[model samples]
Target: MRTREEQQSDPYPTTVEIHCLNQFLMEDWDEEWDRISEELEEQDIPVPEGYYEIQKQILDLHQDMSVVEILESEEDDDGEMWYTIIDVEEQKIHPGMPRYALMFADKPYSTDIFLDNVFRHDMRVPDSLFPQTWKNRQAAKYQNM
Candidate 1:
């Protein structure tokens, strides 16, 4: 897992690479987004454009309205991280999930800003989770099915 500090070293400050696992419900997406936005605002975090693009890609892929998960690395255990699953249709985050991270990979922004936003919220991606490359592979596999 890449540390927030390392990600900040890049030219882009606020960009994240997300692995979209599944589709989420549109109805709940707004409510969940509101909650996420509120949390960021409270912490003074600004997500880059790339983050939104990743989210848009997921949304486009899953038009039926589904839920998505964001996995973060755990601080205490390098092997484990946290997962925040949001139900787009309900527009609310699933219980026992962490807050959403801003700046999806496809979005336009710098890594520095992305790391800044993540650090501002004290967030981390879990090492146990799949990398973006793996996720893309899985997505492609399913596309042919």
Candidate 2:
């Protein structure tokens, strides 16, 4: 039988392996996206809205995209910090587009933080906050874009 000292000295095996694999897969996905984007642009394709969605999926599988894993931190108001895990193949449905999907976290802690931090302020304000005319204008922009 191993002594307490022996167990303490030995590091966990599976965790390290998993971490390495995650890192490798993320790098591979990044490279793949670069190549795919170039090809799409060269083909004069409008780069389907689904492209980002698929990239998000790839990042999800490799644990590379947006997620909110709460961490214990003194600085956090709730003593929890957010972390994200990305996996490929997970589809996110958007409000405007049905066929188009985005790659977003399976779970997010703060909608504000997710929009501001994770999405880099790219999200539109909730429709309730906008006037009917403004909403229609925004919709038109999306349709035309």
Top-scoring candidate (TM-score): 1
Each candidate structure's count of clashing pairs: 38, 10
Cα lDDT of model 1 by residue, 1-145, tens digit: 3433444564333333443333222246557878998999899998877987686556555423233333233433444345444444444554333223222344445545655536555578675686765675578877788
Report the C-alpha lDDT of model 2 over 69-107, residue by residue, as the tens digit.
111112246543322222223332111111111222323
Off by over 4 Å in 1: 1-28, 63-145
Q: Give the TM-score of candidate 1.
A: 0.25
For model 2 the TM-score comes to: 0.24
lDDT of model 1 at residue 75? 38
